[model samples]
Target: MLLCPYNILHKAERRKLLHAIGRCLFSSWDSPVYFSDVVLADIFTSFAQVVGDVWLSLCMLLPGHSILKPHTGVGSRWILPTVMSLPYLIRLRQCVIEYNHQGNTHRRPLYNALKYASAFPAIYLSAAQGMVVGEGGAAATWFGGSHIFRLWLLAGMVNSLYSFWWDVTNDWGLDLLRPRSEAKKSESLRSPPRRLVLPGLHSATPHILQGSSSIDVHDPEGISRSVVELSVRKRCHALGLRHSLHFPLLVYPFVIFLNLVLRLTWSMKLFSVVNVNSHAGIANFCLKMAELFRRWMWVFIRVEWEMIKKSRESHTKHRADDGIDEYELIPSATIERTPN
Candidate 1:
């Protein structure tokens, strides 16, 4: 496992190795396993689905076996919450550790930690509702819409909205919620980060460009200062969005809308309309599949955002040293290497 990192420099290869190491070693390595919201959330979601499938397989092996059914008994009541909340718990711990190590003057980590922590009340409260059995030995309806259910619903809404906001503004690197003037000034296309770090490690540190005026001082390759502003302005106008519009112009708004919709639909698991307590069934499986798909989309955009940020930082550094402000992203196959 240790050799995997030494020999394989690719993040994807290292991720496969880290998956075999399990959750216990998430934060142990010098380059800790990358656990973005998508990854950690997937851990809970995928694990739950796997466990459910395993139990279903067992049920298939021994027909008409009540004991083998997944999440059917009191024991499963606790198990559900543990699985659902474990990812959030891990992130919350990391946030706490970060805050303890580095003082919470800014309170970014603390606030972020609270966002993960919010999942607990909703998860546990939903599980608690299952404990109260109703007629025909089924989970009760929180005593016909009682306080606990209301509180859980409230928690779910808060968590969903907060998480969605963070996903857009923080995770996906889109300042969608900011005012139009500020958003345009800090166009995500123009301002790329100077450094890249894993999520939950640190708050976003934006390296804002020091206005179009500074471009003149840095231009050395006969590339006029107006070219920089023109490039950014043209791209910004083309994209018509305030994010890392690295993809097609319409993609930014499309993903944002889809993300918000999926987030709301995922939260439906908390509602009485969806039988979240039942781990086995078409409804449950469909919900998990939907969440899985949403997370897959999230991973794509999140990784792209990170890569673009890193690329911009590299470009910034190269420009500083080489006096080259503009560069093309050539195909990897087209690059010819010099012999050693």
Candidate 2:
């Protein structure tokens, strides 16, 4: 009878030991190995998609100057945005395929896809600017010296700046306005009150008491509370304002300057100054820019890897210092008696 019990216990312990070993191996494979694969895939995919989109967009925008030529000029302007959007759609499709294949709960791929997609508009805008202004055009007369174009450009600049500012404000602003599920309303409630008071002659008054019998109706918590409320509301608005201004303020001016320089260099016939050598130079410049972008992507990946490594190292050290071993996780006597 004692032998029977001992046999059963041994079998049970053996099964448990096997399970633990399987778990450890699975964890080891899942974390670092799979993580690296996902990261590499994401970095390459993002870089390729962005570059491809930019190239495609440029091709569409400057069809006469570049490879892409639409047979119809009726819907030509729409071609750039449409063609440039393909890479993003392709990336999404790939993510879905990977997700189905991997069958893992980790959403790294999906997250990466969404993040890259979110930046697509901005990327498109930047690339479009490069195509339109960086390369001189027949349409140069419209944008180069036209008052209407300048006004439109100024409007775009102001809008982008305001959008960006509004985005920043909203992002860092009112926690109370965000959805309860995503926003930590409890944390906001628990935050300590700001002691900094507004400086003014009538800081305490809501409406300054300019005349006799005027009541001061200032709520001390009003500004702070308003800030918390404004956080979520202004996020998109601020970002839009800021991003919109970038093209007008920086990109347009830079393009104009480059055009002027090129014109001066080529005796004011910038478009007529084109030659085989010039074409080659332009190609080389584009290739170099692509290379630079690729290198930047690699740098980003390296930084991510380093951060992950440090995080893992710290976690491992913490576990070691705490004397938390996998073997010790189960309180079985058989595990205790096993050799370390």
**TM-scores of the models, in the given order?**
0.62, 0.28
For each candidate, the alpha-carbon lDDT, in order, equals: 0.57, 0.38
lDDT tens readout by residue for model 2, 1-340 = 2224355657776665555434333333233233343333433433443454464546557636544332333344445445545544554545554555545676645554454355344434433443444346427644442443344344434433432332222322323234544344333333222122222332432342211222223555654554453463345223322211212324323433343332223221111111111234575455445444533433443444345445545655555564312222232334568898
Model 1 regions more than 4 Å off: 1-15, 19-26, 29-76, 97-107, 133-145, 179-240, 270-280, 322-340
Best-matching candidate per lDDT:
1
User: What TM-score does candidate 2 get on C-alpha atoms?
Assistant: 0.28
lDDT of candidate 1 over 117-138, digit per residue (tens): 8777877777665555323343
TM-score of 1: 0.62
lDDT of 2: 0.38
